[model samples]
Target: MAGQIPMTRNGVERLKEELHQLKSQDRPNIIQAIAEARAQGDLSENAEYESAKERQGFIEGRIAEIEAKLSNVQIIDPSVLNADGKCVFGATIELEDLDEEKSFTYQIVGEDEADIKANKISISSPLARALIGKEDGDVVEVETPGGQKTYEITNVSYI
Candidate 1:
């Protein structure tokens, strides 16, 4: 089945930049390298030619992959999201752990843009799944690998 690939505006921009670089810089560089290598010798025994050809293949493959990703991207802007204090895609949510009374914040984002160090969780993650549709003061239960945990929604905002 075809799956959705949600991406933040920044993520989409990054992908576009990468695609542009591959097409404009990397592609031309590899073509030149291949041409130079081919000029040096026989078709069958030229190691440099073989290496350059391999590099060209890899670069082309990456270019195709990036193109496909860009084509399928669904861009989302956090600043425009309006869930009315309810957790949703592109929402930055504050939570208080029921057991520890400690607070944490996480932004629900797409898988491609999820970064644990940045406190951004994918929309399809277990924690995000539990938090979705919940408003401030709502309590959500999440089933984690460690155990069942409960968190109280403290705040939800876009951006």
Candidate 2:
């Protein structure tokens, strides 16, 4: 579909797992809580019932959101992508900080899968945007919150 969100295979799997858990476990638990709260009587001043209803609304909203995203998701597998050694979505990149000489590795992924702790960066991020379409040995400058930073692309691999 047009305007579908691009996501890695692993990202899609994680989303599916979360949706499943929410529907199977959380939804049922919330329903039980609401039923128990309803049994306490006095609906207008029932704090437990009100809280359960609010939680139910949040869970339902999240379920709809995840379902919509999954329906419009475009799964991209990194291992099967070929970009001619240039940086692109699903490409794992190795870079060296021009100023600090620090080496780092990151995989350009969808927004949902961006985790700094895991070295996964969103494709729309400043650094990822600068690195995109760049080849090995190329230097790119990125405008960051801490001012401009430069990095040299040491390697790019689809893994």
User: Which one is best on TM-score?
Assistant: 2
Full-model lDDT for every candidate: 0.87, 0.93
TM-scores of the candidates in the order shown: 0.78, 0.95
Error of 2 at 13 (Å): 0.2
Could you give candidate 1's per-residue lDDT for residues 1-159 as a string of tens digits? 155578888778877888899889988998998899888879699888898899889988988887777778888776787667788788889999998889999999888778989999999999999998999999999999989999999988887
Error of 1 at 27 (Å): 2.5
Worst 10 residues of 1 by lDDT: 1-10
- Which candidate's lDDT is highest? 2
Give the runs in model 2 whose Cα sits over 4 Å from its true position. Answer: none
Candidate 1 regions off by >4 Å? 1-4, 36-54
